[model samples]
Target: MQKGKVLSLEDRIPKIKEHRRRKANRRLIFLLTLFFLLIACVVYIQSPLSQINQIVVYGNDLVTTKDILSVSSLKKGENIWKINKEQAKKNLMAIPEVKKAEVRMEFPNNIVINIKEYSPIAQIVSEKEFLPVLENGTILNKSTLLADAPLLINFKTGTYLEELVAQLKEFPSEILNAVSEIHYDPKETDKYHIYLFMNDGFEISATIPTLAAKMIHYPSIASQLDSKVKGVINLEVGSFFKAYDEEEEKSEGEEER
Candidate 1:
């Protein structure tokens, strides 16, 4: 048979129209589906169903959750998108004890706040109360007496404990770990008397700047000490050590000798 050269123009016109109609329908259906999806997303994001239903706080001990939430300006049931994260973080950090603040949002209704509070390295005695002092030189809440860390004495005069506290910051991590107590007397400006109570009964005498250097080798120095001797290991002048008796006066024999 003659292949009929395909179809005539009249027959091909109807098929062409049908194909165009089907293509238009498909495009319309696709557009409608995309439009509905966009609407649904907008509704879900704006509705209260997607708003924050829970507020979680972490890494905070001294500061209460309520205190942080109150200052944060982030309330429950508020839209997550409406909350100003940067402003909330700034407000939380404004609190004196708060060292760092982090604010984050979890989808489907959750707000998480992570906080880092400053730790007290020493106690500052002011008037009748002893206040906890942070590493940043800021004074925190008042504490009665703490046996864990050392108490800084005589911080009023020009020989205030600020110098010692500043020096402590530069100390090596190993030395800082071994240190138990640091004491200062303002009357003697150039000298600092540090009593390091080791796990053993030995006490270490460390002068201001020398303390940091000596403490680096504390373990080795401690190993050389006689177990029977219970006295001060003075690291005041260079590397020389002077072992004083328990009952010996602090400065009595130095001037006499």
Candidate 2:
């Protein structure tokens, strides 16, 4: 034979049927997927897991959970999926005390909010009340007396106060707690001059600019001193010690005697 005959209809029918079958299979799979997705959507919309039934707050001391909830506007029965975490966090950070806020969704009707509050660095004595100063140089009007926190006297809200807050923020808890008060004792040449009266009866004279760097060694300096003796630890430019004036010392001794 020189050439093959044309294929009959019977042979072509099977190929056509096979192509249609593949198309039908693809359509069926797509329809099945779409149906399942629709069902899933409906179920998720109605399920209790989608609703926020419980709200747990952590790491909040100064900022109350009620305040956080109020700012976030988070309420029970609201859809968990609808809660804007970033927006809630932004609202939380709007409060001066809240440093960091993390909002997370726990499945099965639970929402968790974690808050990190800025610890008060120092307190500015206003009349008899103490205004808490944050690390970011923010002054909070809430009045609370913490014996551990240092009282800042004659320090106005300005660059000096900011520097003092920054310096106090870097100090160790023990070292900071040891300080009882910080008095702004400006000198003729140095307006930033300050004096710190420690709870242990020692005093520190430091300038604003060099306070943090030099004051870091306060603990070390305190350790080397006579615990029973009260004197001034000068950290301005250079570290030195100045005992009280002989006259005042004699007067103090006479009173004690």
Q: Which candidate is the best by TM-score?
A: 2
Model 1 backbone overlap count: 0
Q: Which residue runs does candidate 2 get wrong by more than 4 Å? A: 1-37, 245-257
Question: Over all chains combined, what TM-score does candidate 2 have?
Answer: 0.79
lDDT of 2 by residue, 88-197 (tens): 88888899898888999886779899998898788899888888887788888888876667889998889888888887887778788788999999999999999999
> 1-257 in candidate 1: lDDT tens per residue?
66656688999999999999999999999999999999998999878877889999999976889999999999888878888999999999998889999999887789999999887666767777777776677776646565554656556434446656766676665566556555663226455555556546667666665666666777787779787776667676655445566347657777588
lDDT of 1 at 166: 69
Candidate 2, residue 216: how far the Cα is off, in Å:
2.6
RMSD of each: 4.1, 4.3
Leading candidate by lDDT: 2
Query: How close is every model to the real structure, measured as TM-score?
Result: 0.77, 0.79
